[model samples]
Target: MSLINSLLLLFIAILISYLLVQLMQWSNLFDKWLDQISKKEDPSFGNDTEGLLEVVETLPQFTVSDISGQLIGIQELIDNKKTLLIFLNEECEFCGSNFEHFSQLINNYKGKKNIQVLFQSNQKETARNFYDVYDGKFSVHLYKKEVISEVGINFFPAYLIVDPTHSIDLITHNPIQVAHSLNFD
Candidate 1:
């Protein structure tokens, strides 16, 4: 091959390699980038540190059904008080466990009269069954599958702590992890 042709191929290869590297970095394929930038520990990524529990600028609201088939609006539920929202699915095993943990927390803070516990389930009957199985007397509302996407939920058993205006204060997948940081016990 001619030297000019060889050099041209070399240049093309280098450009492709640079493009690939840039794509990976942009897509979060480089873990070291997160390690260097993230506030959490590099090795352990421990939950001991309090996460960013910021007040959300805009709140997403949806209407779901209660066990009794009563329409429940998330914004309406909060009224003027903070809300502890538990998003659960009957198919999720961890959600069941979280339900029990939430029950205890609810009982502990019963007299506070400011925070409301809302369990969002895919099915009304399924949620009711869980409520009955755990002997959970707390009321829950059933959410549709589309509603889940509407609220930008991509994980199961998500726990959202919202302030008086229905603005999110904290959003976490691990309720226990968040509870520990917040001294739920």
Candidate 2:
């Protein structure tokens, strides 16, 4: 009788332990799901997270058309110079506000480094007008609407620095920090 009671107690303890472990796992999964939902609701949620450049092993090659309808390859853009690639949306308010700052940065770096602005919009004329109005001093390109997805960018006003060796680095979302990262004023 004593031996049976001991075995029964041991069995109950093991079952309870298993239940607790499963409950903890389920709770953790629930918490993660909530976090994801909240992040999706917040536009700027993931902007502070580490960007793709930290994880990607290689930069993909791409070709885009400049404002003047010239076909420019990524390699040609970065040829023998450190290139600052600014991805913008003509419709985005934040992007619109930063146009002058970007133009100023490009002007400051003119003849020293390559600065290119890639507008991710379907309206080529709108992009051209924006560039013209701002007196943009950098090479301006109109990217295909799908280029954003192709490059894995989730936000506009994103910055990428391509070194002379063609290696790419992602600057943080802060414009001041991005300018500093490129050693620009």
Candidate 3:
């Protein structure tokens, strides 16, 4: 009888262990499903290459100040010439590393294109310092933090090409590709 009792106890323990393992497996599967759903809901979670292909037809009306405290309207700038709007952040390492490349790109397209560097940050001085360090070659603007969210930008170093008709022609993260799309060298 004692042997039978011991066997029964062992069987129950094994059953419990199996059930616990199944439960864990189910939990893991559920977590994975949840993650997929989250990514699907958030467009920013996907690959940057895919995101860059989307063309933004219209831009939100915005008026931001340049480094010299002059107010500049987005529509007004696009009205004058084909504008290259480069959105950057002061604290972004990617922006810091690519500053010279961007400056060179601006210089390469100078007079041919109105290239503006838009820095959205509450710390105006930091943005100014970043512009000054880069020799202030491009037209730099300082905007409030909300401008980034308003533009639906998930990452820094985004480029948008606005034609004289005030329509956005190309929007991407790769500045070189954008320049190429516009037939810039």
Sort the candidates on lDDT, descending order: 3, 2, 1
Q: Candidate 3: what lDDT?
A: 0.68
TM-score of each model, paired residue for residue = 0.59, 0.63, 0.63
- Which window of ten consecutive residues has the lowest lDDT sum in model 2? 49-58
Q: lDDT at 23 for candidate 3? A: 90
lDDT of each: 0.59, 0.66, 0.68
lDDT of candidate 1 over 1-185, digit per residue (tens): 69999999999999999999988865673364344325432223243223333223446777877777788677777776666677777665456666677556555443444333345454666777766776655556777677665655555566666677766666665544445434321
Which candidate model has the greater TM-score, 1 or 2?
2
Put down candidate 3 lDDT per residue, 131-163, tens digits, no spaces: 787676567788778777776677666777777
lDDT score at residue 108, model 1, on the 0-100 scale: 49
Q: 65-134 in candidate 2: lDDT tens per residue?
A: 8887888887788776777878878655457656567556545543465678887647678769867876
TM-score, predicted candidate 1 vs. hidden true structure: 0.59
**Selected candidate, larger lDDT, 1 vs 2:** 2
Order the candidates by TM-score, highest first — what do you get? 3, 2, 1
Worst 10 residues of 1 by lDDT: 40-49
**Which residue pairs show backbone clashes in model 3?**
none
